[model samples]
Target: MITYSNLGKKGNLGNQLFQIASTIGIAEKNQQEYCFPFWEYSEYFEFQFKECSSVENWTSLREKAFNYYDWEVSHGNFDLNGWLQSERYFSQSINKNLFQFKSDFEIGLLDKYHYLFARKTILVTVRRGDFVNNPNYFQLSYKFYLTALLHQFNNLQEYNIIFTSDSISYCKKHFSFLPNVFFLENLKPIEQLCLGSKFDHYIVSNSTFSWWMAWLGEKKETKIIRPMKIFDGEYSKKNDESDYFPKRWIEHNENEFKLENRYWKLKVYGYFYALQSKIQYDLKRQKKIIKNKIKDIIGYK
Candidate 1:
């Protein structure tokens, strides 16, 4: 068994998710049973995650949780440690049903906002707050966001835009060119993430929070715009000795980010996707209620 008892210690939801997901991925790849500590986010999502218990006859791996090396596989109990961030560790055949909102999750109530996304929509994830003062200069440079928008979209006016951020006021003040965009209030973390996944395109910031917004999306025609490096200012493409961004995503370095090593595409047939589609359809009738309240929850600048 593989265990993640002290996974984050005190990491944010996104950070912990990345590490745990990688553990799941690794366990699946090796066909070994893996166990993690109790997940607090369980209130929002549902999955058959084994709660880690006593560990014995265990060995520890210090790969920094970046890459999946052939030598890292183990048969007995083991421990996974570090800020493991990379799709590489997820293995190509990772489980999709591993994550889904609880049956009572608020996936349906937000579809009224779907009409705002009825047209082409670009969801920009502007994650700041603590990272702004992080000594590593970990935040995405302002230049990265603007440049990604320029290269990916031909006309900003043609698409509906919305953004969710810890610093929404900062985005409103700085992204004046995007005056017509919607400013979504940060909902409960899981609900906000569920909402973030509904967009047609993305401009991801330099955080695991930003990475998962794009990763969890169900849209195939979705266009993603991401910084080449996970963090701004780091020159080594191999950060923490690993590449964080998926090889398939659109990359824009802009010499942005100082650190690296961070880290889902959901298959359409997965239980989550099928359930998600059903929920959206079922929620269609709640349009009047959602429509009346959407404006109150969303801000316009």
Candidate 2:
């Protein structure tokens, strides 16, 4: 049997797929086999072996496969030259050679958390560096989300919100005021201990770091919420989908807490690390406009 782990962005889409794959036991068979598209137009996919003759079976089998699903705008046409080339390449190669268990065992693992949090509890996750210009955006979102969650889950008295990310220090600096949210400064160690458990409703930011939290917390019907828009521009507003969540699970957005448009324009340069391609696009458009103005001043060549 094969068990594979996710190496994608740590939020909703990644988390949902991870839960589906783990529950289905698709990653254990060929742990080493994996693939990710490098082209800007390519679709993303996750695959792992279900069974094999030996661990070395995939020595000759290439893991490359095409996936055409386009759920997020970020996955649309992008300039590969603008991406964090090194990190993108590295993330593509991430594959875990772990064991696969029956779906029953997977449910059992998730049950550990259910048993621990016997009382009603709300589990919220925040990703660090989601909004570089408005550092407080996620902080505010968490506050509003927590408030709404408490209101919805009337009996949810105990709140155990866990925050996990690459930059726990940064997240801590901004979100220290929350009353009872459990903040794990670093995620790697916690992942080893919990082995993916604990969490009820996952309030994920735009980052994929929280994907595993939602995936591993699926035993008790987890609700995963993410942003309708990651960047600021005309968002093409429409009806909110918070009402579409499962009864046992709910996905609500704190769009009311979204940062103002003025602040978003101020974010053109500082987000190179977070939204690299978009930054490059911004720079390119700026350069083109500059060139056109120069031509107007000096008379075109």
Top lDDT: which candidate number?
1
lDDT (10s digit) by residue, model 2, range 1-301: 2212222332343433443333232222223233322212112222343332233332221122211111111221211111110111122223221223344544655564454355444445555443543422333333344444544454543665555655666446444555455555433433322433355666655443344444445664555664543333332123222222223434355544444455343334324434664476567768989999999999997
lDDT of 1 by residue, 135-159 (tens): 3445464556755676678888888
Report the alpha-carbon TM-score of model 1 versus the true structure: 0.74
TM-scores, all models, native as reference: 0.74, 0.41
Model 1 stretches with alpha carbons more than 4 Å out: 8-10, 64-68, 91-94, 133-135, 176-179, 232-238, 253-301
Give all candidates' CA lDDT scores: 0.68, 0.40
